[model samples]
Target: MTAGPDRPLVVLVHGAWHRPSTWDAARSALAALGYETRVVALPSAGRDPAPTASMYDDAAVIRKELDQVDGPAVVVAHSYAGIPTSEGLTGATNVAHLIYLAAYLLDDGESMYSRHGMDVPADTTGLFPLMGSPGEALYHDVPRDVAARAVEDLVDQSLLSFTGTVTRAAWHDIPSTYVVCDDDRTIPPALQETMAAHATATRRWPGGHSPFLADPQRFAALVDDIIRSR
Candidate 1:
């Protein structure tokens, strides 16, 4: 299928502790469907020689990518990615739409830690503490092999990223759709629903946190449908 006027470039932003490769399957599926896509490598995610980048740095990277897009683009932000994506897309005219896949949608001056009613933890080793048993929390619904690989591919997220609050909420101006993974074990579904209230639209999916990993083709189709319906 040819990309229509309404079909914008798809930019995939992975969540914390995840690299760009996490969207490999979904990116391939989108490509097969004739959709051009870009996956962001979050500097705050996993940095060699330890990470020093914060959420602001991550947002700058996203802004740089959006600046390069000549036409309209749709940004898909997953989990923690939503934080930087929201901050990054502020006043970005090229962004046609935003899809938050089981992600947080913080408002201006709010942060992940603040949203949860917790104080920002002190930066330890310049990274956030990795969750225990990620395979169970993130990929319980995924295939055994895929789940294993996903766990192995997980990396340290910069604590500064989470501590940094959003300066602007892109969702306030951009039309956005929030996809809530109803069965997500990482972020509570209730919290997902709560955050979904901030979006232009919301969708609920019966899966774990990483739907793209569990079923990439189906997830890509869902993304396509959402973009088209908009």
Candidate 2:
């Protein structure tokens, strides 16, 4: 599959408690496929101060990276990053597509918390309050040993980040794809289906929330195909 110059650049944006390193496997695979892959680490998830971090802060990080890219890019936003990606891509000539990986997809002026109503299962609540520094939180889904290993790679995310609203709706202007993880324990599969309803295309994988780590090859292939198609 030959990719065109006008073809979308692949930018992977990770959600809260995750650093850009989360996409390392997928990045290497996509790079080998002849596509440029850039991972934007949001300030909210950085070692720096997260005092005023909000959804727009994350959006700004994405916008800054998008400006560095030469052409339209395919932004693959995972989890919380989707909220900002939805707002950041507005009027961005360089954004060719928006891909959500079991992530939040909010409409204009919508916040991530808006989608977390009664639809979410009660068990999902226990996953929060993850261990980390005062400002940063890590995931509690994996086993203790695995979680400990993974926690070292996590960044801090503020609660205010989730409450921030996305004033701009990038989805209305950009083509989108959603990859639903059937085995997702964080975000329910049913919720993922509802979120993907507005996407241009939908693909499913038999992995958990962190499919890029659980099934890197399949995840990379799907992203590569999306870039090639564009």
Candidate 3:
């Protein structure tokens, strides 16, 4: 866990109803801060006709990305993406740290659908869901124009991603950080606090569920500070 001058690659996992492009601003900002970045295009949200992708599918893709990296990497999971990221980082030797940003931090055998003991959003039948516009699901504090662009790019999410359980939780082994968006609408801050207990370090921000979209420069600085403090 010692800090190293060589910046590790920062791999970003966007939540449900999102694409890898969601991390565009953060990727640019991180690069400016001297950190290489990669974005994961989760398979669960893909355009395939059959219901194929699950949490394991997404996690396997992430593990492949981790295996390909030559040096240590930091994996940051946003919202629902945490499920896949956590399960994916279980045996990733190249991962130096794991970061959860207002994300679902599920224990082993736990599915996103059962989080807080809530009912699953859809039936067992394959379903694709859309994200809420602007303030409803995220980006309440962001400029309207910015939020609009984000909403316009939303993707349909597979219900399978929610039902699949994680076989492993990366936070148990890797040095981990959790960033709680205090005003998050998607994942309540109270639940986020409950999950924060497992992280090596925890931070709070007054942003919405999608804080990186609200202000990537500030979010990037916060992530940079985290790496420095470690």
Candidate 4:
């Protein structure tokens, strides 16, 4: 689906261990193309410090954003944010499309962690740290400084965020575009390809998990193309 008469607002949903600031680079590029940007502050990502924060909580916040926004929107969900966005955009009239940027696209009744075969019970919940060699695992292909800043900005995520199952699959109805980051060390490109089977279209990037950070302008251009496509 192509962009409608109204220039779609881009609601960026960041994944685990990140804040809305993760979209700064991509937002600037989208702004240059005259696209408005809205970043969702997911409650489950440890933003609110609320005790009940889970994927469901995050979806509630996102659905509220979709309800409050002025016009058609395109939600760009990265990594774990995909789960909430999928459920959050359910029945949301303002959303024109969903752009899953290396994000999990779960089917109804699927939890992001369970989809990956993690042996977590559905009701399990807690805080999980982003432990690993940050550079090699997440940003090997990204610039050093950007990777550094990302690590500094990272935060612990709610365990339930992954264990929580989506009740509705928004991508099943909303037009979607998936991008597989070939060099990604976190989420395998092969897994991304498997997820893309449900997308309206798919693209590839020879970058790591966070291409928007590696090359924001280029990533934005790709998103702009998706916005303009049929």
- Assess every candidate by TM-score: 0.95, 0.83, 0.92, 0.93
lDDT of 3 by residue, 71-115 (tens): 778889998888899898887777888889998888888887677
How much is the lDDT of residue 11 in candidate 2? Answer: 85
Best by TM-score: 1
For residue 157, give model 4's deviation from the true position in Å.
Answer: 0.7
Error of 2 at 105 (Å): 0.7
Stretches of candidate 2 above 4 Å error?
A: 1-7, 118-128, 131-148
Instruction: Give the per-residue lDDT of model 4 (tens digit) for 1-230.
Output: 23344578888998887889988988998899888888999887754445457888899899988887766889999999888999888888778889998989888888876788878865555576576787688778878888888888887787667678889889988999998898889989988899889899998988889988999889988988888893
Looking at model 3, report the run of 10 residues with the lowest lDDT sum.
Answer: 125-134
Candidate 1 wrongly placed segments (more than 4 Å) = 1-4, 47-50, 122-125
Q: After superposition, how far is residue 108 of candidate 3 from its true place, in Å?
A: 1.5
Q: Each candidate's root-mean-square deviation in Å?
A: 2.0, 5.6, 2.6, 2.6
Clashing pairs in 1: none
RMSD of 1: 2.0
Per-residue C-alpha lDDT of model 2 across residues 104-186, encoded as one tens digit per residue: 98877667666675232333211224443412223333345555656677656666676767787788878898888787777
Q: Which parts of model 4 are misplaced by more than 4 Å?
A: 1-6, 121-123
| Clashes by residue pair, model 3 | none
